[model samples]
Target: MKILLVGAGLSGAVIGRDLAEAGHDITIVDSRPHIGGNCYTERDPETGVLVHVYGPHIFHTDDEEVWDYVNRYQTFRPYKNRVKTTSQGAVYSLPVNLHTINQFYGKTLRPAEAREFLEEQADSSIADPQTFEEQALRFVGPDLYAAFFKGYTEKQWGCSPTELPASILKRLPVRFNYDDNYFFHRFQGMPETGYTEMIAAILDHPAIEVRLDTRFSAEQGAGYDHVFYSGPLDGYFDYRLGRLGYRTLDFERFTDQGDYQGCAVMNYGDRDVPYTRITEHKHFAPWESHEGTVCYREYSRAAGPDDIPYYPIRLVAEKALLADYVALAEETAGVTFVGRLGTYRYLDMDVTIREALDAAAAFRASAAAGDAMPAFVKSPL
Candidate 1:
């Protein structure tokens, strides 16, 4: 069978490799002249330090299988993500840990006392929170919410917290104890080489041919036995329905001597600050030493047609738009939509890989049994 994959990111690359190993002829196409998608990294010409071109993506997952699978491509170094936030004029540890609570309120309360204190601080009126603002106020109270989350959330989403869903804040941790690990995932590390090398290895199969700077069209997919799409879901249907809302990022890059932020990521929670966060690329690869460091000040804005969509803003209107696309996808034949953009959801690298693997396995099983291919292995909506 000849398979055509759109978007040579992790999802496309993984599925391509899997099908190719099964003796299927695979052709992968990506609009970008790159392999890793947003996870792409390259060495800085000036300092020779590895930089995440799009933004910082720390490979962290609880799935042992995922960790083992990625390790096959490159050696991974142990790296823990420790993030700090600047609110007003002071710096505080992120995820609202014990130190943050103490320093912010000017009190040395213990873990139990702090937890109780926060409960008291929280707005009891918001019993069943629906919006982001209500959730934040209910969880951390007005003062902390105003300082840390209110402005940052506004900048990141380009909307007031009241317009956003409560689920947005659910992922964030508000620990009473001093555990400041950003993610609770079991496996967390950075690839020793870079994400691009790992993706290159995945698409390095003899049966697979990768076409960079090429766009996959419906016309081009006719010759193939099956097509696996990892591009935008709305793009597949030619936007017959309205465009799904997405938050895109604009990165401001600059060179600096010595350390800039002294950390991998620094969040600017103050509303006065234009950008959401600043990422120090050198800190991401602590294994390598460079006198000069490069940093990116990230600004989030509404995604336009030409901009690269980073986060899917699944607000009420966008969800309705996505539903129409899903309906169209269901009616369509001979194609499977997989990955973040294809599914029209914000997916982490690990989840995207896992879903792609699942899709491949399901495809193989269907083919072996002489069954028709599933329209979607997992529902995007």
Candidate 2:
């Protein structure tokens, strides 16, 4: 079987490698000059620091299979994400932990006392919180929401918290204890070599052929037995119905001597601050020593056609547009949609890899059984 895998990101590379290993010929195409998609990383020419070009992607997953799968490609260095946020005039820990709560209030309260205090702070009026603002008010109350979340949320999403869905805030944790590790996943680490090298290894199989700077069209699916597109769903259809909403990131690059911010990521929670966060690239790979440091001030905005789409702003309007695309995808043959952009969801790295592995396995099983593969291994809608 000849397979046409588009986008050459983790999804495409993983699926292509799996299919190729199964004795199928795989041709992976990517519009970009490099692979790894958003997770692309390279050593800075000047600073010699491993830079995550798009942004800092800390690989954290509870799934042992996904953890083991990535480890096969590259050696992973144990990395824990401890984020810091500056609100008003003071700095605090992230995920609204016990220390953060104490620091914000300028009081040293015990766990039980802090929990009771937050219950008092919480807006009991919002019984059934529907929006992000309502969720924040219900969980952390007005003061913490205003100081920590409100300004930052507005800047990050470019919308009032009331306009966003409650599900967005649900992902974040509000710990009553002092666990400041950003993610609670069992396995948290980063590739010692850059992501590009890891992905290159994944696509290094004998049966797999990679074509860089190649744009794949939907009409070109005739030459292959199956097509797996990991690009934007709207892009695959050329935006016939309408463009889905997405948030694109803009990074202002600057180099400095020694440590810039003394941390990997620092979130500027005040709305007055123009940029959302400043990520020191050197801090990402602390095991490597460098005299000069590279950093990026991140700015988030609505994605234009030419801009690279990062976060899918799956609000009401975008969801409707995505629904139409999902329907169109289902109707299309010899094509399967995979990855974050294909499904139009904000997926973490682990979820993306897990889904790609499943998609590849399903394709192989279906092909062996002489059955038609579904357009989606996991439903977008």
Candidate 3:
């Protein structure tokens, strides 16, 4: 079988690797000059610090299989994400824990007491919260929401919390204890060198050919037996239905001597601050040290035609547009849509790899049974 993968990101690389191992020829093409897509990492020429080229990507997952799969290619250094946010003229730990509650209110309340205090502060009137602001007020009340979430949410999503969906806030946590670790995943780590090198190792098979700085088109799918389209779903048909909404990020890079913020990620909860967060690239790999440090001030905005799309804005309007695209995708043949862009969802690194692995297995099973491959292994809606 000859497979043409549209993008050289995790979806293409993982699927291509699996198919190649199964005696299939795989050709991967990417418009970007690198293999890892948005997760690409490179060392700073001047500072010698390994930098996550496009914002920070912390690998954290509860799936043991995904953890083991990545470890096979590179050394997995144990890492935990401890995030801090500056809000209301002071700095505090994130997730709104006991320490944060105590610090903000000037009280030494314990875990249980803090929980009760937040409960008291919470609005009991809103029984079924639909908006992000209502949800926040119901859970943590207006004071904490205004201080920590309101400004930050407005900055990140470029909208008021009142306009956003309640589902968005569900991903966030309001911990009772002092646990500040960002994720609840069991396995959390980063590659020793960088994501690009690890991805390069995955595509090193003899049956797989990787072409960088090459853009793939729907017309090019004729040469191969099948096509794995990991690019944007709307892009395949030239966005005939309409372009789906996406939030793109812009990084403002700067240099500093020694440690800049003494942390990997520092969130600015104030909307007036302009940038959402400041990421110190050197702190991502704390095992390595350098005299000079590299950092990026991340800014979020609605994606334009030429901008790189970071997150799918699956609001009411975008959902309808995505449905039209999915219907069109289903009518098409010889191409399978996979990954974040294909499915029009914001996926974590582990979730993306897991889906890629599943898609590969499904394709192999379909081939063995002489069944037709699905346009989508997982539903976009």
Candidate 4:
């Protein structure tokens, strides 16, 4: 079977690799000149530091199979994301742990004391929290929420925390202990050789043909037995209904002589601050030593037509538009939408790979059983 994969990102690459390995001919196309999509990383010419071209991407997953799968392509260096935030002229550990609580209040409180203190600070009047601001106030109190989350959330999402969903705050954990690890995933690491190399290795299989700088069209799908569209869902139909809302990032890059910030990611939680975070790319790959450092000051704003879509703002209005596109995709034949943009969801790197693997496996099984391939193996809605 000849398979057409439109997008050289993780989703298309992983799916293409799987189908190719199953003896199916695969051709992966991307509009960009590079293959790794937003996960692209390359070495800085002057600094000798490997820069995350897009931004910092830490590979962390509890799935052992996914861990092993990526490890096959590149070396996985043990990495833990310990984030910091600067709010109101003070720096604090992120995820609002015991240290952050103690520092913010200027008191040395134990885990139990900190927990009890937060409980007292929490507003007991609100029975059920609906918005992000309410959820934060319910969990961490006004002071903590104001200092750490309120300003940052406003800048990141381009709206007030009250307008955002409470579900967004649910993903952010408030801890009683001093542990500052941003993510709780069992396996946390970065590809030693960088994400681009890892993904390039995945697409290196013999049966797969990668076409960089190629813009694949819907009419091209007629030539292949199956078409995996990993581009933006609305993009397939050329945004016939409406363009989905997304927050795109603008990276203001700069170079420093020595270690900058002494950390990988330092988030600015002050509303006065223009950018959201500053990412020192060298700190991401700690195993390698570099004299100079490269950093990016990240600014988030509404995604435009020409900009690359980063985070999907799947608010009520956007979801309504997404439903229309999903219906169109389901009714359309010989096409299966996959990945973050295609599905219009905020998916982690691991989840993207896992779904692609599953999607490919389903295709192989269906082909053998003479069953029709699904419009989507995993539901976006």
> TM-score for all predictions?
0.99, 0.99, 0.99, 0.99
Per-residue lDDT of candidate 2, residues 240-338 (tens digit): 998998999999999999998989999999999999999999888889999999999999999999999999998888888888899999999899999
Where does model 1 exceed 4 Å of error? none
With a 3 Å backbone cut-off (N, CA, C), the pairs that clash in candidate 3 are: none
* lDDT, candidate 3, 182-214, per-residue tens: 899999999999999999999999999999899
Q: What digit string (tens of lDDT, one per residue) describes model 4 on residues 250-331?
A: 9999998889899999999999999999999999999989989999999999999999999999988998998998999999
**Clashes in model 2: which pairs?**
none
Candidate 1, residues 300-341: lDDT per residue as tens digits? 999999999999998888888888899899898899999999
Clash tally, candidates in order: 0, 0, 0, 0
Better of 1 and 4 by lDDT: 4
Local lDDT at 57 for model 1: 90
Q: Looking at candidate 3, what is the lDDT of residue 84?
A: 90
TM-score of 2: 0.99
Give the Cα error of residue 234 in candidate 2, in Å.
Answer: 1.0
How big is the positional error of residue 60 in model 3, measured in Å on the Cα after superposition?
Answer: 0.4
